[model samples]
Target: MSQKNSEGKRSARERLQEQRRKEESRTKRKRTLIAAVVVVAVLGAGAGIAALVAGGGSDKKKTAGPLVAPQGATGKDTVTIPVGKPDAKSTLTVYEDFRCPGCGQFELGFRDTIRDLEAKGQLKTDYHLVTLIDGNLRGSGSLNAANAAACAQDAGKFAAYHDLLFKNQPQETDDAFGKKSRLIELSGQVPGLDTPAFRKCVEDGTHDSWVKKSHEAFSKSAYHATPTVLLNGKDVYGDQKNPLTPDKLRQMVTANAKG
Candidate 1:
């Protein structure tokens, strides 16, 4: 009886130990499953955030209505901000982005010469505003600024506002134009531009789609890079050997005019 009791006790202890081992194994599996689930959830959230940012942060793609072309739009893809007489003999097409520092440099270097030629009615400039910088830089500043410039076009203040945009452009990485209020504030500096309609246009992003269309055209065009200056439909800065200067621009325009 004593031997039988001892054997029974040993059997009970062994059963308890087996039960504990099974329970531990089950718990570990549950914990691993939970950890795997957590890891998957974290990865999923990160991917979603990455996608959102890739899609231009919070700026949703415009999805309604026919795109309203801004004032003086020569094509669905371009806004022809007339700098000189409509009958000017030569045409200077300038493709630029508001957020591009190189574009700012180009404008600072050649604005005077371009304006002088425009004043003389020797050349007409077709300003092709694009937004490539916004895509590369991961923000909506370029798009918003271009939209605001289009709004200025509606108010007949495109030239002044355009110059201001370039003149006050923040660093390449800085997205100062992301806010609609900033664009409107800049417009106030341009006399007679701070109107209710202009404000509504800027705030409402009235020309955002048109800006996108212009960028599409720019992307398809042969000339790459911001501040692409084409004289008589030929790239003025394409030739690195004969780099363009203010004097060179004037000479080219004069020569084109004579031709």
Candidate 2:
């Protein structure tokens, strides 16, 4: 009886040990399955977020339009005027005085308008300045300024020099010659051009003939004002109350182009 009891006890102990081993293996398998599911969920979430970001980036690319500069003038030298579009169809002729307050106002107003229209090739203007503002500007005439301008034009940088002169004009005083020298000094600062050659040109009065011719034209024209404006070959500004409105200019430009 004692031997049978001992054999039964040993068999019961072995069965308990086997049961514990099987439970541990089952637990490990469940842990591995859970870890794999979490990893897959994280990867899937990352892919979705990346796709959304890419879509937003593509939309941003589509919404951006063409680029434009502050002053719409193509930085060219064809008209010998830096801030003008050479290809515009509606030709504008301005009889300007370098020292005239009205001329300054006209410059600011006209530049703003031309910027918008230049890109569309809708406006072309020729500045035929008269030396009327020079002598009296701080007590000197525009002859020196005109001489310098002619020089710049000969240097193939008339446009740049013209814009510079208008932009950096000094206050009216008794020293207009000083201002003239300063304007000429500035002409040397433009890039990729021969400054010494330009200086010689201005010194020699290269555009003297044209300046004289332009003065003759002004003298012969039906208008006589500091800011005498011709829209498509007819004198208009300095006579009208509303001289330089964008809407009116646009209308005139459109009509002139059509004609």
Candidate 1 C-alpha error for residue 154, in Å: 0.7
lDDT of 2 by residue, 74-112 (tens): 222222233346667776776776666677677777766
lDDT (C-alpha, whole model) for all candidates: 0.84, 0.59
Task: For candidate 1, give the lDDT of residue 37.
Answer: 100
State the TM-score for model 1.
Answer: 0.76
Q: What TM-scores do the predictions have?
A: 0.76, 0.57
Model 2 CA deviation exceeding 4 Å by range: 1-87, 135-141, 174-180, 254-259
Task: Identify the candidate with maximal lDDT.
Answer: 1
Model 1: per-residue Cα lDDT over 56-121, one tens digit each = 534444332358888777744455556677888888888899999989998999899988999898
